[model samples]
Target: MEPGTARIAVDLLGGDDAPAVVVDGALRAVRADPDLHLLLVGPTEVAAAVTDALTPVQRARITVRPVHAAAGPAHHAPRADSTVRAAVAAVRDGTADALVSAGSTGATVSAAALGFGRWDDVRHPALVATLPAVSGPVVLLDVGGSLEPRPATLARHALLGAAYAAVAHAVAAPRVGLLSVGTEAGKGDRPRKAADPLLAAATLPCGARYVGLVEGYDLSIGARADVVVTDGFTGNVLLKAIEGAYAMAGGPPEIGGAPRAAALLGVAGTVVVCHGAAEPADVASGIALAAHLWRRRATDRVRALLAGAPAHSSPSDSIDTEVSP
Candidate 1:
C-alpha cells in the first residue's frame, strides 16, 4: 500500500441500489487509491461481493463489519444498528479515518451527529457541495442538511462554507455571498434580508469576506463569489436543477458536473453523504471525497476556525422549508 493510508468505512446497504452498486464503487475506489483501505459495513454476503472482485493483494486491505440493516425510507426513523450508524461508529471508535454513505441524508446526518457530536455554537449542521465554476470551485452550503433555516443559520452556513473552501479547496481569501433573487442588497425574502447584514458583520476565517447578495446564476459561473450560502431547501433545488441542465446539454463541463455527494459539516468526524440514487461512480467519488477530507484534517480545521468566530444566536420564529428525499 502507498503511504498516508486513509481507512474509510463505507455503508454497503446505504443507496437505492445497495450491495451491487456499493460493491462496485468500493472496488473501484480500492483500485484507484493505493493508500485507501475500506471497512465495509453491511451484510456478509454484500461485503463478499466486493472482496471477491479484488486480487489477493487488494483484498488484504479490506475488512468487513457485517450489519444487515439498511437505511430504509426517509420517513422511517433510522434503526439503532443500521449500516450507516455502524459506519459512523467505526469512525468514532477510531477503526476508520472517515465514512461515506449513499443513504437517506436525514438518517446519515442523525447518525453522524449522534456519534461524532456537533461543534460548539452550531445547532444545525450544513451539507457543503463544491461546484466546478468557470473561475474556480464554488462552495455551496446547506444543500440538504437543514431544510428550514433561520437567518442565523444562514450566517452560520456562511462561516462553514468560507472555512470549508479554504480548508478543503485551498481557496485563499474566499469571497462569500448570500443567495437571493438579485445581487441588490434588499432583494430577497425576510431570511435573506436578515442574513445579509449578519454575514457582513460576522468575522470570516481564512480572510474570507462577504460580497453581499448573489443570484442563482452566480453559482454556476462563479463570477461573483467563491462561497454561496442559502437554506437547504433552495440550495437543494438549485443543485438538482443544475444537474438536470448539465444532462440536457449532453454532458457536464470538462472540469466536472454537479456533485452527487457532499460533505457534512458541524459534526466532529469526516463524513460524506452521497445521493440516495447514487451510481457506482458517484459512490466512488464520495469515498474519495471522504479520504481527501480526512487526509487534509478538514473537519478538525473547520471546527477550530468556527471556535474562534462569534456565536450566532438563533431566533425564535424561523422559516420552515421542505424537500423530498
Candidate 2:
C-alpha cells in the first residue's frame, strides 16, 4: 500500500450479478486498502450493502452517487445515466481518481473514452491483461479493447505493451514479441505476417527489442517475451483459455496466475475492467489494480513514453479484425 488516497468510483450496477458481487467486492476492497476511498455509483440501497459492512472509519470514506440504470448489454447503446457512465463521469469531474467496472466491455470502453480523451498517439485504445507466468509477469495487450488492430496498430501495441511492462510492472528492458501461429519468421495469418515487419522496425521506448515471433506457449512460460502483442480477439480468447486452464489445475500457482481484471490503456485516466462474470474477489482485484496503477502514476508515465516515440510514423492505421458485440 501506497499512502495516497485513491478515490475509486465503482459501478454498482455493472457485472453479470449486479449489486451483490459489486457490493461484496467493494467491501473486500475497502477492508484491504486503508487509503482507498470509494464513490459507489448505483442505487442507494446497493451502495449501502458495501458501507453497511465496513467499520465506522471505513464507512466515512465512502460517498454514494445514486444511478438507477445499468448498461443493458453489449448490443444496447450505453445510456448517459448508466452506472458505468456515471463512474466515468466521476473521474472526469475530479470526484474520483480512478474507476472500476465489471460491466459489458463495450459499454465500459465507450464510457471511459467519452469521459477521458484518448492519447493523441493512441488511435486504438488497448486493454492490457497481466498473467502470472513461470518466469515472472507476462503483459498481454489488446485484450478485447480493439478487436482487430491493423498491422500498424499491432506495431503500436507492441511498443505500448513494452512501455506498460516497464513502467507498470517494473520489467527492465522488456522483450517484446508478436503472437503468431509459430515462432518462425513467416508462420501466422495475413495480419500477423504484415505486423511482423512493422513490429520488427518499430522503436520500443523502454529498451525493449522485438524478439521475433512467439507462440501461445510463450505467454505462459514467459521464456520468449515479456510483452506479447496481438489482436484483441486473439488476446481475449487466449487470456480466457489460460484462466480456464488455471481453474482446472486447482488454483493459480504461487508465482502468480491469470488475472480476472484488466487495465485500459491509451485513455488519459486510470481505469480497470473486470470479467463480465466476475466474482466478488475478481471485482476486488480490479479495484486494487486501479489503485495500484494510480499510485504508480503508470498512465502518465506511459503517455510520456508515447510522446517520446518517433514523430514520422503514422500511428493511425486501419485493422481488419472482426469485433464481437
Candidate 3:
C-alpha cells in the first residue's frame, strides 16, 4: 500500500446498485489499505451503515458528507449536496486527493471539468484505460469522453496516451497506434484517414512511436500498440464489446479483460469513472484505481508533459460546461 494518506471521495449514489455496492466497495478498500481514507458523499444514513459495519479502528478512517437535496432543488448547490458533484468538490477543495464515481459519465465529466478545470488545449477530456499486456501495459484513450474525433484531437490523444503510459504505468517506451479497421495506411473512415498522417508527423513523448494502424484484435490481445487511440464513441463501444467477448469466452483471459473503470485525463486532479452498472468488485477497483492515480500524480505529470509539447490545432469550439444529454 502507498504510504501517504490518499483521501478518495467516493460517490455513494453513483452506481446502479449504489449505496449498497458503494458501501461494500468502500469497506473492502478501507480494510485492504490501512493508509487510505474515504470521504463518502451521499445519504448520511447510508454512510452510517458503512461506518457501523466497520470495526471501531476502521471506522476512524471514514468521513461522511451528506448530499441531501430536497425535492425541486435549484442550482448553486453545495459540494456536499450531490453525490458526484460532492466528490468533485472534495478534490478541488483539497479535502480529497482523488475521486471515484460510477455515476453518469456525462454528468461526472461535466462536474469535474467545471470544478477542476481542463488542461491547456484539452477541449474534451478523454477517458483513458490501461490494459495489461504480455509485453507491458497498453493505454487506450477517449473511451467515451468525446464522441467526435478530429484529426488534431487524435494526434493530441497520442501525446496524452504516450505520456500517461510513461508516467502512470511506468512503460519506458510506449508504442502508440490509431485504432482502425485495418493495419494499412488508408484503411479507416475520414477521421482515420485524416489522423493517420497527423499522428505520423506528431512528436510523441516518452520515446513513444506512432504505429500506423491496429485492428480490434490488437485491443484484446495487445500484440500491437502499447497505446490505442480513437474517438470516445468508438472506444467506448469497442471496450464493451471486448468485455462481452471475454464473457462469452467463458471468462476474461488470465491477463484480464478490458477495464470497466477509466481514468479521466486532461483534468487538473485525479478522477476515475466506473461503469454506470458497476458492481461491488468494479467499485472497489475504481477506488483502488483512484488511489493508484493519486499516488502516481498521473494527471499533473501528463499535463506537464503536454505543456511542453508542440502546438496542436485549436480546441473544440464548443466549451459548454453542461455535457450532451
Tens digits of per-residue lDDT, candidate 3, 215-279, equal 88787767888999998989999889888888898988787777879999988889999997888
In candidate 1, position 70 carries an lDDT of 88
lDDT of each: 0.90, 0.89, 0.84
Ranking by lDDT: 1, 2, 3
Q: Measured by TM-score, how close is model 2 to the native structure?
A: 0.94
Choose the strongest candidate by lDDT. 1
How well is each residue in 61-160 modelled by candidate 2, as lDDT tens digits? 8999999999877866689899999999999999999999999988988888888988886655899999888887899988999886578778888888
Clashes of each: 0, 1, 0
In the range 1-325, model 1's lDDT, one tens digit per residue, is: 2258899999999888887889999999999998899999999998999998999999998999999898767766578889988999999999999999998999998888888998887666899999999999999998998887578788888889999999999999999999999987799998788788888888899999999999999999999999999999999999999999999999999989999999999899999999988999999999999999998999999999988887655441243232334
**For every model shown, what is its TM-score relative to the native structure?**
0.95, 0.94, 0.92
